[model samples]
Target: MCECKALPIRFDYTPKGKVEALGGDLEGYVVAGTKPAAIIMLYDIFGYTEYPQIKQVCDHLSAATGFTVAIPDVFRGKPWSMAKSPAKPEDNLIGWIQSVGSYAKVSSDLKLTVDFLRARGAERFGIAGTCWGASIALTACSQPDGVFEACAGLHPSLFGKDKEFAEALLRPVALVSARGDPLETVQEVVNGKPDLAPKCIWKRMDDVEHGFCAARGDYKNEVVTQRVAEAVQLLAGFFTSNVA
Candidate 1:
């Protein structure tokens, strides 16, 4: 489960993108750039509207990687909560995923996002997801007719552990795992598998929690900032090398 209250809202950094409709009535924050390779960034359980940090992270990745990043509103307009802590269990992090139709609905929405980008002249694509979003990214890349060229999962949760999921990775993938996360088990599986090893890059962040990548003012210490920078650099390199 993610600690939603760990990070504080940052009002200083405003997002550079505009929320536009991407067919199927789904809207996303599209950050325009010059790169031919576009990346579809899936949001965590907090959804897009819950935190400004999520949008800021999207902006940073778009500028840093030079990839036209699009963050689809997977929950449509309904986010779990903007409050640091939810008053009810149904509104908590775990309950929110259950309420939003989970991976099945998110994966369906991701396909629409891919089509939207494809129509906009994006030649290549990299799909990156965090936490609950990572599960959807993994599933998207697993499909035989999947359009993404590269996929990344940062501090993933609710990932499939079966052999089929491992065998379905058709392109390069970077898995950024936090220490002590159950997601590390899948990271180990991807690392140990002979067939998956050549294109798989597993990076484990020591002494950090799941939500460390997102810039949180509350947790903005030197070490957290460094880890976030390192994670961004790693993803930029992974997308550059794999998506061409």
Candidate 2:
């Protein structure tokens, strides 16, 4: 029984393609709490439109920790349909990956988000993502003096043999992965890296695949769903300890 509840949110459309940044209107949700903390979340390749499950995650996190969660639409203003998306899921993910603002284009997206929440009377900040969004979460925190005081990821996709991205990640972060996931190889590469942030935390679950958090039967497992809920709880705790 999750006490998670969803609050109405406003979308502030940002055109990043022209600005060359993490553009698009941000999707915001507030959960009932006293003195809410603020957090930003990124979605996976399936895009935010495909699954309503992520809203549950946001609501759950907010209910557990009193955080004002904001999820950004990074799909270039394009919605995705499970049955009608043009590119394969992986390709769609990669496209968004390549779309993240360059180092020079970091702009005010993150900072503006922090300011927005603070303006709404929030006091703490955090970030989290899943699958493709997981990597972005890590990178966002890696920025010097990142607005997010705490961050987490489940089944992150940062398992490349190279440390290029990992090295840039300089903030404390948590990673949750499934042992049976096809992307487990990438998880291994990330966990095995020697230069991971001193605050990087890693957890691996067995009998789960890449998109276990997704509601789709193809990737969802009851046990794994339980595991993901647990992971979300852990992330809320981290945000509590570090952010608020």
Predicted candidate 2 versus true structure: per-residue lDDT over 119-222, tens digit per residue: 76877777887765676677786779667776677776664622555555555667777664323443354566565434455678766666666434132445
**Candidate 1, residues 1-244: lDDT per residue as tens digits?**
1111112223465678899898788999898866677899887766666465567666666666677889898888776554644336554666557667476667778778878887887889889888767767777777778788778887766545534555566666787877754445555567666765676677888768776664222335666666665666677777777774
What lDDT does candidate 1 reach at residue 208? 81
CA displacement after TM-score superposition, residue 91 of candidate 1 (Å): 6.3
Q: What C-alpha lDDT do the candidate models reach, one value each? A: 0.70, 0.58
Model 2 deviation from the true structure expressed as Cα RMSD, one decimal place: 7.4
In model 2, the runs with Cα more than 4 Å from the true position are 1-25, 76-81, 84-96, 100-108, 159-162, 180-200, 215-221
- Report the Cα RMSD per candidate: 5.9, 7.4
In TM-score terms, candidate 1 sits at: 0.81
How good is model 2 by TM-score?
0.71
What is the model-wide C-alpha lDDT for candidate 1? 0.70
